[model samples]
Target: MAVFRESNAAPYLQPVPPVVGDAKVGGAAPHELSIGEIIRRERRLSQEQIEQILQYQREKGVRFGEAAVALGLASQQDVLFALSQQFNYFYAPDAKRGYSNELVAATQPFSHQAESFRAIRTQLMMRVFSQDDVRRAIAIVSPDSGDGKTFFAANLAVVLSQLGGRTLVVDADLRGPRLHELFGIESSSGLSGILSGRAETSVIKQVPDLPSLYVLPVGVTPPNPVELVERPAFALLMRELLSKFDHVVVDTPAAVYGADATVIAARCGAALVLARQGRSKVSRLQDLVATLNNSPAKLAGVILNEY
Candidate 1:
């Protein structure tokens, strides 16, 4: 709910003086400090103020940073800046930095758009990952093309990677793969090569700037995408990737691709439905959901992409 001006300046800077409590003495570096410590150092909240927030957190079972914001000891921006510093997240207000401008997570870390993605990530973490019966691999699906599934998947992966989790975005949309273009990486050999056993090495490509994020592009669009995905090798590959990565997000072709998305989702064991505003038809979406219901994958949730 905090609005930040569009600027290239560093989002987090050293605090000038105390507003609530005594200044913090020499301690850990800003980046090395924990969330509570960072808030204490940056906001100069007194030890009593920090203790009060901690007590509130313990009673309400909420985070220390959230308790601080609720008590008006620090603003949301203050806590988020501290979080970014703690996680070493990069914030780029300018979008003309080679990566797609549409990727708000990479281009505008503090923007509302990126915040929305983070919210989605949190929901998925609780709903999918926190469960006793949780699924690691997730398939992002849509009823048709141009519904922003690929865009959402890419940004979601970036935001998840920002959590310091080892995240992998696999381009399973063989008919028209775009992640390679989104990440500006070569698609010379990838999923297809791995499936066909033509490429000996894994084609997982790491984003140059984002060390935690990796991508598996759809290489050399094969004539039979559904066949390639249906093979047992594809399932094995997914299992292997899941064992190595903290989160595996697969961007699949639309439902129109003759069960390609359904197959991938079933293999992944979880699916996120993406519907574009004004562009996606409700009837078609219902049909796609019905199809997914029959598969092994659980319907995680539907995302209405406004952009």
Candidate 2:
């Protein structure tokens, strides 16, 4: 596919012209950026710092997004969104609202968690910070819940919101939907609420700070979550979401429990499987990876939770 360089890109987001290795397009991949490496790349991410970087890149004609992609933080293509359709991760509550600074506070230390999160958020600011399409993914898994899927999801969504991506966290997990709990919102009225045609759109809660990350908390538990997940209505919802927001992220159940994870994966552009530090089973996740290979959605990869 022909890669369309961002028309207004400050030149810094483009690939360095000539690269080495499968993950490169310009000079020898700028050396795999480690956690420490990236933090150094950014002197600071404040508006002034960002402006200075953008100004310097604009003057030098550097491609910031490409640079980030070369490091595996950004995709050269709209692969994230395209993959979502290719796999069928088409379930969603709605397009998230506008992003806010408050969201960032909710999800502190995002850089300390997933290295990808740090870089992606930075690159997203290059072209589309205040839009949902920019940051539309949230990886939610449990090291038995207390380990913090909802915490992470809520925070991740918040991060995206701060970075100008209208985000949303869907309680697709009928088993234990607790995003509302994390945000101190109402849980009795979300996906299930709208799916079963019980409540109006008003039922959906607007998470604070994360006003950009809307919350369609898990509605009434269904008898057959698998069936609900497979319904055409669910698929349509996802497409509609893409049209409405800059980004939409759903908080799904674990891979071990039900088909919900697979269903959620099918609708999103990609998937991030999270496992806890000690409680999570390596062998089981390996099996889960194998399971994702056969799933309708594409497996972005696993996120081994260190904390």
Candidate 3:
């Protein structure tokens, strides 16, 4: 006989913790050198310094870079640059550089991180575009904030556009909009403006140097983001974007907070969930997936963002 246990917990009202797992979005080629070796070869640390860091790493069970930083042998920035080189990911030393420098895919196409995004793009092409029945708009969502949904959407758009596909990344996360900052554009007019009937055009700004890529920021924060998202205008806006652009990527707020992600995903008919490694929790991710499964959008496979 099966024993039954009483359930007394309330539903999770807050944004759920992200689910962490192996990186599934991009497939990276194998590298011959390790991080420590790369750092040594880059001259960030001498042979003797490497020996000291290794001794510390074994004793403390910490990473080589961590040991180096602790010993005051290398700056955090130097370690990061070396790691980027080791993993073939992009790293810009200067923060004041323009938008191109800010975009990893644009600045370092050869980097493994950029290649992973390209792999995701290929997967999406087959998942979302291979079928002739669905619309082109794809919504990207996360279990909680700071999971890198905006970063994924922006870089994915850039990579997709690089292939000559006309792509548009929409900042649908009205509560904490960031596409404007990512693309280095003004947010004076965007989705909020369009929904409020304040802006006539959905094309807020075109990404410089990438004629095929465009960005639609959250123009002005609205008091009721869920209400705005549920409006007919939002659907109309999506349709218009799909008709005009070859690929439309919409960035939504965290699934744990409000119903905005559900509304947007339902309207778009397709969605991709992102979760960062180490930070996301398994239980929370399962709950978020259950909620998403109830929506109209076809759930694309989960992406484990390792960066």
TM-score for each prediction?
0.72, 0.56, 0.68
List model 1 lDDT by residue over 26-81, tens digit each.
65444556888877876789989988998999999999989998899988877776
lDDT of 3: 0.72
Compared with the true structure, all predictions reach lDDT values of: 0.78, 0.50, 0.72
| Top candidate (TM-score) | 1
Residue-wise C-alpha lDDT for candidate 3, range 1-307, written one tens digit per residue: 0001011111111221211121112242213456666556545567788899999999999998789889987667667766554443433333443563437876666668878888888888887877677675889888888888888888888888766656778899989998888767877777777776666543357665455677888888999999988888888777767766788899999987888987999888888888888887878777777877887888876888777
Model 2, runs deviating above 4 Å = 1-147
Which candidate model has the greater lDDT, 1 or 3?
Answer: 1
lDDT of 2 by residue, 1-307 (tens): 0111101112111112211122221232223433223332322335554455456557667665434344444343322322322232211211242322223334333234434455544543453434344333433543244554555566556556544444566677777776666566766556765555554545446554233456767767777776766666666666656555555667777766777777766766455566777777778767766766676554544555455
Which segments of candidate 1 are over 4 A away from where they belong?
1-86, 91-97
Pairs in steric clash, model 3: 15-256, 18-280, 18-281, 88-112
- Tell me how many residue pairs clash in candidate 3: 4
Regarding lDDT, does 2 or 3 come out ahead?
3
Off by over 4 Å in 3: 1-97, 100-102, 200-203
